[model samples]
Target: MKKTGLTIAAALAGALLGSPALAQKTVLTVGMQSTDAGVLDPHLNSGTPGKAMLQWMFNGLVRIKPGELSPEFMEPDLAESWTSSTDSKEWTFKLRQGVQCHHGYGEFTSEDAVYSLARAASKETSAFSSDYAAFDKVEAPDKYTVKITLKQAIPSLLGIVMNYHGGNMVCKKAAEELGKEGFAKKPVGTGPFMFQEYVPQQYAKLVANPNYFRGKPKLTEILYRFIPSDSSRDLAFQSGEIDMMLGRQEQAWVDRMNALPGVKVVAMGPAEMSMLHLNMSQPPLDNLKVRQAIAYAVDRNAIWQFRGKNISRPAVSVVPSGYLGTDEKAPLYPFDLAKSKALLAEAGFPNGVTIKAINTTLPSMLSFTEATQALLKRAGITLEIQPVEHATFHQQIRQDLSQVVHFQAARFPIADVYLSQFFHSRAIVKTPTAVTNFSHCKVADAEIDAARSETDKAKQLALWKTAQEKIIKEVCAIPVNEMMQLWAYKDSLDLGYDLKASLNLGPPVLETTRFTK
Candidate 1:
């Protein structure tokens, strides 16, 4: 259901790669693997690195400038202030004056905000449109204030706003002028960096927004290089060709980087979760007993050892360990091969069943799939892992091509957003209105919906707890690992904020980042 907005001409424009800087200007170059920048339209998703890089060029009305110690805090961004109705159905925003878009896109106004939200709330352009399902209408009282009325009171309304959490707040005038193809090539936003040049599969360059509302960025330029090979990225870092990088996931790689002088290896916690989802519509796995067998068969400690204990821990909740409703010690189905085989026999598959799964060929992902294949073999299950290119894997999974889809993703703040996006019947795949419910498991619909409606924080979390417990009790999915992320950088720069963890898995390089030398 994803669309590519890049025109042939725009793609050709992106093909002409640029050389790295010859001088030591105030610039930071980040290296990564894979070059699918998605649509580059904020309305559409541009994978993880694209969104992290976009943070330099875009702002929501309010933003999460997470603290060095406490990242959950929210702060004001484009919208200086606002108020909500007593019932939280009607909300109003007071826009800040003197903010400018990157291009000659004219000063941003309520009209732009109105257009952005309506587009984000529509499924034609957005994957998380259901996240904004509560919005009834958006109205602009004047140039400085915008009001949004909700269809129903949503407990996580603040999390749904298009402007917060590194999501996009696009300008209407710029988008219409360029059209989708042109806009994808040359996006205009109100952030510290502006689009300078883009060369697909090679590099994207951004220059500081001089007239930024928050003041000009300290780093004059950001140069992003696409180095798809893991060994190539490490060699680039070691040879002083790149400034920073998100390194490989195994601990041996982290230890190697740590041994090098002037290289900083940071492990950022409360990060992404890696889960093995069972396609309930698929054969054999459709039986609850068979699904439970897969859960009981997993030895989480073995996975921790294979992946690295320093980077991961056994996951107990569909929610991450630090969050509410998470229990690390007493998972409903703890590791027990005997129980796994027992369930398999009860389901009439005593000799076990053959299951086919697919995943991207990223080293970390393939590593987990290999480990799973080995362990499941001991439990009398045959697993065939089909390796596909990153883009094809994402596309094929939605088509229900695999019974097991193992995916890794960054964290979301609210439990309701995570559960609903992955579990709700309305979010199930293959339907015309499909979202992210890949498993097609539907035991906790009542609780998931109730959690969204509950206004009280404590009460709302209890509902989410019930829903998470159901995922385990019924063996809908197996929570393989929940772990922090590791990234390495040359010791020549000072990243102003804490990189302990980011909403997006990349480092927070912004106005505060600059070279120490």
Candidate 2:
């Protein structure tokens, strides 16, 4: 089953369709905690798993680097050379040669880039939507050259391009000729794999892409099995039912996985930050004094005590440690019950404010939520806990717009991705129509705009710092602690866990992977 890196497509082709002596292609069954049961539309789907699946089945002009988190993907697949203006507001890309689209979609062209980006930017196509409201235009100068104009200079432009939702490239002719339904039904891409079938809630079946610019994949078929429960996924992994597991909630479970004779757990550093966010749209959270008090009240050490030593680290800023602009000097809101009570009284809630804290049914999150409840109780705040399914909770966060919720925000390689996703008004979580400001805070839109436009690294950092101060002072979202991501696989499998959300689960790394049989 071993295939050389340079000759992967040849090896797979020989194994799958060419060699008579070779057996059928090996199918890797990947187990995950959640399912892509709702929407296959890449733009509309909020889950990371869905984004990962789409990534394998499509190709973008630019991609994320395999193991790095700097927002630039080396070895351009579609676009060979990309240059950005000194100010970083404008960018242009030169497309590669001999790149053919799968499913009879035709060759790679600047039109495809324009069509794809425009589609993602369009409000009509929900699947291609993004927080890139600042994107002014995407134009095709020639068949192989594409130019992009942004409203502001953002250092994270490359990071945003490599974003899971934004990175997928679409066929211009197929997209226009077939429309949304046509494109969705039989999507085409110039990737290593081709979409064979999608059985909602079961699996997304894919075969090797023959017209893939690079070549065919080593594996004949990839079966992304959507296993809903952690217990089921763990049991399946233990029983040798699946080849790989995507993500695990608790370190103990991941440790247990490593102890198993056939499985090994892969731990990625600073994967996520789990926190209890207060809704600034509400009356109690609207008061900066009360928000500061809540930030001061929580004992992150005690909360992480449930997870044990080395499992989690206390977070001082909304952005985690690994990302840029995380200063050690940033004030850490140490636990102070006295301050919490005083601030609550100052906010006119002397008795305490009753609030609902919503969370998903993930086991580790349950423990984290309970710990938050206990901590808030010490501050004389009454918390009503509500647990929902992960998929449902993701949907609820988008729809109901609650006051308080148990949230786990992931850490990206770049600060811009982190800042833009949560802070920017253009992000998907915020309602596009409403000017209410989704974090429900009193942040100056003009400040966010300035941060988005500032290209100078130091100046951008300063702008982000200002915004962070405003967010913290207003108590937009409380930073809890940073957590790790764990994945278990057979030792025969050589899988690298990528720190950047855009890169880890994408095609470039997957293409380089070689599994021993």
Best of the candidates, TM-score = 1
Clashes of each: 2, 4
Model 1 poorest ten-residue lDDT run: 16-25
User: How would you encode candidate 2's per-residue C-alpha lDDT over 290-344 as one tens digit per residue?
Assistant: 7787787788888666664455677767667767765444566778899999989
Clash number for candidate 1? 2
What TM-score, over all chains together, does every model reach?
0.91, 0.86
lDDT of 1 at 331: 52
Query: Scored by Cα lDDT, where does model 1 land?
Result: 0.77
Query: For this target, which candidate reaches the highest lDDT against the unseen true structure?
Result: 1
Q: Residue 47 of model 1: what lDDT?
A: 58
Consecutive 10-residue window with the lowest summed lDDT within model 2: 500-509
Query: Positional deviation of 140 in candidate 2, in angstroms?
Result: 1.2
Query: What TM-score number comes out for model 1?
Result: 0.91
